[model samples]
Target: MDPLLLLFSLSAATCAYLLWFYLLARNLTGPKVWPVFGSLPYLFLNRKRMHDWIASNLCSTGGAATYQTCTIALPFLARRQGFYTVTCHPKNIEHVLRTRFDNYPKGPTWQTAFHDLLGQGIFNSDGDTWLIQRKTAALEFTTRTLRQAMARWVNRTIRTRLWVILDKAARDHTPVDLQDLLLRLTFDNICGLTFGKDPETLSPEMPENPFAIAFDTATEATLQRLIYPGFLWRLKKVLMIGSEDRLKKSLQIVENYMNEAIDARKEKPSDDLLSRFLKKRDMDGNLFPISVLQRIALNFVLAGRDTSSVALSWFFWLVMNHARVEEKILRELKTVLTESRGGEPKRWMEEPLTFDEAEKLTYLKAALAETLRLYPSVPEDFKYVITDDVLPDGTFVPAGSTVTYSIYSVGRMKAIWGEDCMEFRPERWLTAGGDRFEPPKDGYKFVAFNAGPRTCLGKDLAYLQMKSVASAVLLRYRLSTVPGHRVEQKMSLTLFMKNGLRVYLHPRTLA
Candidate 1:
């Protein structure tokens, strides 16, 4: 035989063998696998509506432990790499997030993705380092003085800063973008509470602020990483291309502002969260180092600002769509406030809403819960399998695979939430006994603030902040959606409104 003919024959045979192997493996895997692209084609078909696409697939493929795999071709590699993805199953989530948590650290992959923005903060760190930071944060967050101070600051921001902006928009008959306003308010409030310095984001003129600008840019760039993984970025970093330069610039802006704030706080020693974190001594009596302080400050900026703002923005949007629900919330707010005060127009914003006060507003809490159910700010979370384990439902997850829990999808699951799962009904959260609803387990179902050991410590503070702002604003102004304004979701680590939520605020007159 000719040498060229022999070579061609050999190549054809090898291709045939690999094709047969892939088809055989696909049959065994139980997930719908396309020939060469695997699941990528299907995913691309529904890329515009990714969450719904995945949810529908999960539903059809059977609930809980159903596994799906996707293959991506890489240059210099002989065979394609298989990546497995899964949906919400409490026990499976528990195994990944809590039970064998040590085995499944955030890993270097996530650290690289978030490092340019979050650095080595608790949100990205793992192992003993994460534990130390979490412990210190929890201690500071739950401290009486810090809690009291935060409450006061949140209430004051709601009353003075936030309301003033809304009032101006209402009076001038200018349509307000509630999403942008909420973001600004939360940024200002969190900055004040954490660093004892105001960014003045809610000012009348809305002056340009580099920190806020960079923060928004950083968030958008971080979301891009989800579509293209960080390893790809690391490769690009080698060549020094694409958004790498932009990301570096944003990080520098954030770091410069943080370092300045830290320096000022160190000199002044005020009673903000940063000051407390700086002065806080560990069990071994060592103060948090400057690097740790910077990490903590950046973590607070990410956590404290985005979560509350996103939640509040969604809550208001829900209220606008559901007027009857808004009526119920207003009724509940009135009853609670009236009972709290003896019909006196005293300083409502100066005092913190006590745990008892928060409890009394059952409908308000329910409304917020329903909002979170439908539009969780942190829509999805991923956990990589550390060890091979069988889930409660008896599905086996192999080691070195990533499992994603769709908090957004779980909230809308018919199996979990009944037939009306997709509806934004606040009444679903009201118990038959007329009390606020509670989850069966805090891990997967009600995972808006996450669950188990890594549950968000700022959950209570977030609720308080949202309630204060909602009550204060709704009592004074009636917000209606601006005509033909389409509100859509932007896919990011945080669920933000793609187009700002434009609304007309009509000031309510006291009867």
Candidate 2:
């Protein structure tokens, strides 16, 4: 047999196989897929701007109503069996989140990835574990005492620490990292509300808090487990190297702080969430174990700290860009001040808004809502499919596949929010009279807090905290972004500003 003839035969067979694979993947609406490598190359290339990349792919297929769902096929990576069905379609999101709620839990991959950081906490657990915690938390959140406790923490932080720092910055004419400041402010606030202990990350010196640093390290390392292949992270864990190694040290610091706080709470219970959780019994009529309590405290911090701060950061940046919206918010604040405090701008600027006063900030609330629509803290969320299911848009997702609903993409969809969806118009959220705030009736359309049974229990609390901080800052100071400073999004579990919101503060004066 001639060697050239044999080589020609093999080459022909390879071409035939490649042609078949291309034909099969041609109809799929997602990033370009390659043989063997699948979409890995494309994903790696666009990793920095993943959310926008996904939105572009979905939009290119067709707008929301036509082709709102797309598939990403990965040949390796055992999680979700290497198949992901990403969708921003409201109907499909509703079906996955509400109608077939039981069919989708946080699932094993998510639980496993976050177990060291979150344990069997409500956010990480499924079934009975999550249900019991949710029921208990729901009850506690509804209590006026808890809300009052949160208010006290928030007001004290603003009046004592945040205002002083911002005032100093204004006086010195120095640019400050508002995002970093907000992160510290919220961290202190959340720690106080969660465990009755404040790390005081927002102090005058703006010193580093070991506990806060450890928690951030741990959270970031844990997220790496989700991004890298399951086996890769697991092997790193076994070897005690890389991000897994950092996770171990960070977890130790986090646990120590939590244990100390838990011991203190046990000795003398306070009005914080930790004290309330300590008083409650678990599934087996037992007090939650030390381990469980630690995770619960960490979970609340993880939820309360990042989301509110990130949302506030984006809100400030948006307001800084849109002066018309800022003027409207100021006018509304002035109206509220006039009605309640004899219209003294100077006196009002001296103090933070009380919880009751923050409630009167309806337009400001709408602006915050508008900000969240465009920049959700958690831009994308993935749910694992339990049984084989058919989505509302006639797409079939297998039992082991993962479905990621893009909250960021939803805000950009023309079909869902009309042609002006991309515009930063708070008026869309207001009533015709412009006096009252109103959100879309469809829960799925605005899922920054998510929808259905798994909706955020801290929804009202988040609003309260944001309103308090937002009103406090805006009333006292006018924020201007630093010239030539770029604002870019960080690709993470949360939507953080990559460069931080660098701004100079100008003290507002009565005209």
TM-score, one value per model? 0.90, 0.94
Residue pairs with clashing backbones, model 1: none
> How much does each candidate deviate from the true structure in C-alpha RMSD?
3.1, 2.8
lDDT of 1 by residue, 1-511 (tens): 9999999999997788677756545543334565555566765566566666656766666455345565443222112124555666556676667777776677665666777777778898887778877898888788777777777777676666777787788889999888888888889888988899988887777778999998878877776665553466777667767766677788789889999999999899888889878877644578877777887788888888888899889999888879899888877766777788645535443354554576577788788988998889887777666677666667666666556677777776777777887888888777777566554444466789887678899887888778777777777778889999998887667888889899999987533
Looking at candidate 1, what is the lDDT of residue 295? 74
Task: Give me the overall lDDT of model 1.
Answer: 0.74
Best by lDDT: 2
lDDT of each candidate versus the true structure: 0.74, 0.86
Off by over 4 Å in 1: 1-17, 20-37, 41-48, 73-82, 280-287, 344-356, 441-443
Question: Any runs in candidate 2 off by more than 4 Å, and if so which?
Answer: 1-27, 64-80
lDDT of 1 at 319: 89
275-339 per-residue lDDT for model 2 (tens digits): 98998887789989999999999999999999999999999999998999999999988888878
TM-score of 2: 0.94
